[model samples]
Target: EAKASYWRQLAMDEIRRRSEYQPNTRRARNIIFFLGDGMGISTVTAGRIYRGQRRDGSSGEEGCLSWDRFPHVSLHKTYGLDAQTSDSANTATAYLCGVKANVKTIGVDSRIKAGQCHTDKSTHVSSIMAWAQTEGLWTGLVTTTSVTHASPAGTYAHVGHRGWEGYVPNNCMVNDTKDSARQLVEESPGNEFRVILGGGRMNFINNTENDEEGLKGNRRDGRNLIEQWMKSKEGKSNASYIWSKEQLLSVDPSTTNYLLGLLGSTRLPFVMEQDKNCSSYPTLREMTEVAIKILQRGPKGFVLFVEGGLIDYAHHANRAAFALEETVGMDDAVISAMKLVDTKESLILVSADHSHAFTIGGKPERGKDILGIGGYSTDGYPITTLSYANGPGYNETKVNYTDAETTDPNFVQKATFRRYLATHGGEDIATYAIGPWSHLFSGVQDQTYIPYAISYAACFGQFAGSNCHTCKTSTG
Candidate 1:
C-alpha cells in the first residue's frame, strides 16, 4: 500500500509538471545539439537504471535523465541513403548537413561514392556550422571521439571517405583533394571558430612534433596544421590553443575570441578508464562547460555540437559497463550544459547517430544490479542482463557466469555469434528537443529533419525570414 501510494504521488507530480509546461515559440539564439553516438533506447534505459542504482542506491526505474525532462520527443529513422542500417558518417551527414549520403561518406549528398576522390567536390553539402557561420553566429564542436572523427568532421569538413582525416587511403591517389584535417585547418576558415574542443591531436600536428601525451602525429604530408591555425589567429585577440585541462580552465571567455583545445591525443579517455586524480584530459562535462562559456561570448549567439562518442566505442567492444558509464558521462554533460543556457533563447536537441545491436533481457527483480548476471538459462547457462546479437563474446564451449565479474570494466557480455565487432542496429532512435520550435520534432521524422529543424529554428540557411527574430535584429 505504501509503495503504491509513492508511485501514485510520483505520477501525479509528473502530470503537474507536464500541465505547467508552456512551449517557447521564440526564435532560438543558440543551439546545443548533443549526439550520443550509438546510444539506443535500450542503452538509455540501461544507463538510466545503472546510473540510478550506482549513484542513488535506488531501483533506477523511476530516475529521470536530463533529456527525460525535454518537453518534446520523437523517434528518427537512422538508415543511410542506400542501407537499412546506417554508419556514423552517413547519419552524421544526414543530421548535420540535412542530406542523406552513402555509407562512410561525410558532408556530401547521396550522389557521392564512398572512396571515389573525383566526385568529392561535386556532391559536397554544407553543414549547419557553415550556415551558422555565414549568418555571423559563432560555432564550435566537442566530442569524446577524435575531433576529425565522422560525426565532428560532418560539422565542418567534407571528404569522400570518413577515414581520410589525416591521410588519404593508400590506393587513392588524388593530389588535388585535401584531407579532412586540411579542410578543418585551412579551408573551413578554421580561425573563425569560437571554440573547438575534443580529441584527435595527431591529425593536426606534424610527425616530428609529439602531442600533449607524447603521441606521434599521423599526417603523411608533414604539415603541422595546428601551427598553421595558430598563425592565422596571430592578430586575433584572446586566441589560444590549449592541450591540457589546466590551461582550458584558465582561459577567460569574456576576453577570448577563439579557443582550440585538443583534450586527448586520440579519442578522449573512457569514463571508466580515466584516472581523475592523474589524467591529463578533461571530462566531457568539463569540456561542455568550457565550450558554453566561450561560445556564449559572441553577441550573435552560437551553435555547438557535443558528441558522447565513447558510448559507441564501448558498444562495439560489447563492454556493457563502459557503454553505460559513457552514457552517464554524457548525461552529466547534458545536465551541466542545460544549466548554462536559457530555454527561452536556446534550442537543445539530444539524439544518437545510430544504435548498436544491444539488448537487455532476463528480467531480474526490480532494483537488481543492471550489470549483474541474470538467473540460469533453461540450458543451465547463466546469462547477463546485457548481451549483444553478435560479438567477440561468442564462445564455442559453454561457460559458467555464476562467479564471473560481469560488472568489471573490461567485461564483455555473451553473444549469439562471433564477429570482429558488434554491428549497428536498424531500429528507430529517439530524439529529444526543447526550446524554440521544438514542437516540430513531434512524431516520427527522418534523420534529415534535424538539421532542417535547427536551421529553421535559428532562422539560418533556407529558413531565414522575418520569423527569425535574432536574425532580423542582428542583420538589420
Candidate 2:
C-alpha cells in the first residue's frame, strides 16, 4: 500500500511539473553552459544517491539532482572525428566550436590533425565565446582545471595537442605552434573576458614566482604572462588578478569589470579534500557566484562556461567518492546560478564532454548506503556498489572484501581488468537545459547540435537574422 502511494505521489509530481512547463522562445540575453567533464549516466546516478545519503540516512534512489529537474533533457553522442570514444579536447571542440575535430585537437575543424602545427595555421575555428564577444556579450570561463586545459582551451586556444599547456609535445609533427598559455595571455590578452577564474597559475607566471600554495613554477620560458596580462589591462579596464580566496572575496564586482583568479598551481583542491573550516581556496560555488556577479555588470549581458573538470580527473584515478563529490559541487554551483539569473532571459545548459567506464550495480535493496559494499558475490567475496570495467583496483587474486573498507574518500572500487588509469566510455552522455528554446533538446542529438542549439536560442551566426527581435518584444 505504501509503495503504491509513493509511486502515485511521484507520478502526480511529474505530471504537475509537466503541466506547469512553459516553452520560452525569447532570444536569450545570457547563457551559462556548464560542462561536467566525464560525468556519465552512471556517475550521475551514483552522485545523486551519494548526495542524498550524505544529507540523511536514507535510500538515495529517490533523490534528484539540480539539473535532473531541468525542463528538457537529451542524450548526446560523444564520438569524435577519428574514433568512437572521444577525448575532452575533440569533444569540446565539437560542442563549443560547433564542429567535430580530431582527438586531442582544439578550436579547429576535422581537416586538422593532432600534433600537426603547420597544418593548423589557417584551421583555427572560433568558438561560441568569440561569437558572444563579437555580438557585444561579455564572456567568461570558470573551471576546476587549468584555464589552458583541453576543455576550457577549446573556447580560445587553437592548440594541436591538449598537453601543450606550457610546453609543446616532443613528438609533435611541427615546431612553430605556441603553447596554450601563450595563446591565451600573450596572443590574445584577456581575450575579452569579463571574469576568468580557475587553477593553472604556473602556466601564466614565471619560474621565479612561487604559486599561492608554495608550488614551484613549471613555465619553461622566463616570461611572466600574468604580469603581462596585468600590464595590458592596467589603464584599459578595471582588471584585477587574484590568487587566493581572500583576494577573490575582497574584489568589488560593481567596479571590477575584468577579473582573473587562479586558485591553484594546477588543479584546485577536490571538494572532499577541501578544508571547509579554513580553506585558502574558494569552493566551486563561491567561484561561480563571484563570476556571475562580475559578468552581470556588462550592459549586453554575458556568456559564461563553468566546467567541473575534476570529476573526470577523479574518474581517471578511479576514486568514485571524489568524483561524486565533484559532481555535487557542480550541482551546488548550478543552484547558485539559478538564484542569480532570470529564467526568462537566460539559457542554462548542463552537459558532459564524455563519460567514464564507471559502473554502479550490485543490486542493493532500496535505501542502501550508496558507497557501502553490497552482498557477497557467488565466490564469497563482497562487491561494492560502484565498480569499474578496468582500473588499478582490479582484484587479480580474487580477494575477499567482506570486512574490507569501501567507504573511504580515497577508496578505488574493484575493477575487472588491471589498468593504471581507467579508460573513458564511448557511451552517450546527457545534456540538460532550460530557458529560451530549451525544448529543442528533447531528443537524442549529435554532439555538434549543442552549439547549434545555443546559437539558435541566442540568435548567433545564421540565426542572427532570425525572428528573435520580434520574439523578444512579444515575450517581453
Candidate 3:
C-alpha cells in the first residue's frame, strides 16, 4: 500500500504539472482557438447529458466540465449579413476576420467591385493566422474536416465564394488560372504555419492523377506540396510530410522542423469509424497532440487552430448518436491540449460558429433501454420514442415504433424520428475560454464579441472593441 501510494502520488504530481496554471512562465504569446464546428448550445448540453447518463445514470451535467467555469463567456449573433440563418463560411469569417460578411464569403469583407453592380471584392483583411505569421510566431491548423473547407479556409485564404474548390462555376470568377481550393491549403506559407494536418487531399493535388487509395479521383498535383514544404526550410530546419498513420507516428519529432499530415482524402472518418480502425488511423486527439509538439519548437510561441469539424456534419445529418460521440471526441482533444500548455501565457478558446436545430427534452430514464419501445405512465399517458423539429427524416406517428426494422431500417431511414416539438430553442449558445486573459468572457454577448474578446484578452488582434471592449472596459 505504501509503494502504491507513492507511485500514485507521483502520477498525480505529473498530471498536475502537465495541467498546471503557470502564468508567469507562460510566454504570453501563444494562442489556441478550438472550434466545435456546428456545436450549438443544445448539442453541447445533450452531449454532456448523454455522457453523464451513461456514466452514472444521471444528467449529463454530472459527467463533464461546464462552460460556465470559464472566466469569460459570451454569445454571438450568428446570422449572415445577407441571411438570418448563417453557414460556417459566413460565421468563420466573422469570428476569424473580425468582419461580418455575406453568406458564402470566406475571409473577405464586402466591397462592391468597381463598375460591377452586385459584384464585390473583400477589402484589406488578415486572419489571426496571417497576423501570427507576420509576428514571426509558429502557426499550425488541425481539423477533423477538410482543411480547405470553409472553417479552415477562413484562416488562410480569402475568396469571394466559398465553394471555389479547384473547379469553379462559370459565373463565379473571372480568373480560371488559380484554384481557390489549392490556394486555401497552400497560401499559409506567408504565415509560416509549420504544421498543417487535416483532410482535403483533392485541394492539394492536381485534377489529373488519382489520390493515394480508397478515393476515386485524379487529385494529385504533379508537384508535391509536402516535398515543397520540406525543402523550403530556414537554416537547419527540416520538414517531414506524412499521409498515413504509420508515417505520422514514425516521423522523428526532434528532427522534423515542420510536419504536414493529411490523413484522409476528404474529411476524416467519423470518430466511431476511426476507433474501429485505430491501429491504422490517428484520432483527433492524437493529431492535436502531434501538432502541438511540432509547433512548440518555435520560441516566439505559436498559434494553433484545432477543429472538431465533423460535429456539424453529424448534426446536419441528424445523427444524434454520432454527433454526441464526435462531441465527446472533441472533448478528449481539449483535455489533451489542456495537458500540454500552461494556462497563464497560453489562451485556449472553445466556441461554435452557430447553433443547431437540435433539442433535448424527454422523460426517458437514464440507461433505460435507449433501444426499447416507449411506455405510458402509470396514470395513463403516452411517451415519445425520439424527436426532432424539422428535417428530412421525420415521420409523424401516433404510435410508438420500437422494432429495429421499424425504428431504423437504413441510414436514410434511420434518420427519421418522431416529432416532440415543432421549433428550435431560442436560447443563446455557450462559449468557453481559459488561460491568459480568459477572464474577459463572463456573461452573455453577441457573436461578434468572440473574436475581439479572445484577441484583446490575448493582447493580440489589430482590431479590438465592439462588444468585447464594452465587457472588458466596463466595470459592470
**Every candidate's lDDT:** 0.87, 0.85, 0.66
Task: Please provide, for model 1 over 1-476, each residue's C-alpha lDDT reduced to its tens digit, 9 standing for 90 to 100.
Answer: 26898889988998998899777767789999999999999999999998899887898977888898888999999998789999999999999998888999889877777886743466788889988888889999899889899999999877888999888875565556777878887776344678889999999877877886789998887799888988988887778899998888898888888888887778988988878688777889989998999899878889999999999999888888999999999999999998999988899999999989999999677887888886778898887888999988888888886535887768888888999899999999999998888888889989999999898889888877655645455434
Query: Candidate 3 — what's its lDDT?
Result: 0.66
lDDT of candidate 1 at residue 118, scale 0 to 100? 49
Q: lDDT tens string, model 3, 1-476?
A: 24898879978986786577443322246788889887887777667765665545764444664443455566767776777777788778888878787777777666622112223333635777776665567888898887778888778766666665444555444543234455643455332668888887766565665567656432433544444555555464676667877887787766677777778787888875654635576778888888888887777788888889988876666566667778878888888888887777788888888776665544666544332334554655444333345555465544444445333312222223444322223346567877766756667776667767655654455532242333355356
Span of ten consecutive residues with least summed lDDT in model 1:
467-476
Return whichever of 2 and 3 wins on TM-score.
Answer: 2
TM per candidate:
0.95, 0.94, 0.79
The RMSD of every model to the true structure, in order and in angstroms, is 2.8, 2.6, 7.5
Candidate 2 or 1, higher TM-score: 1
Worst 10 contiguous positions by lDDT, candidate 3:
112-121
Worst 10 residues of 2 by lDDT: 467-476
Clashes of 3: 16
To one decimal, what is the Cα RMSD in angstroms of model 3 from the true structure? 7.5
The local lDDT score (0 to 100) that residue 160 gets in candidate 1 is 85
Q: Identify the runs in model 1 with alpha carbons over 4 angstroms from their true place.
A: 1-5, 170-175, 189-191, 467-476
Candidate 1 global CA lDDT score: 0.87
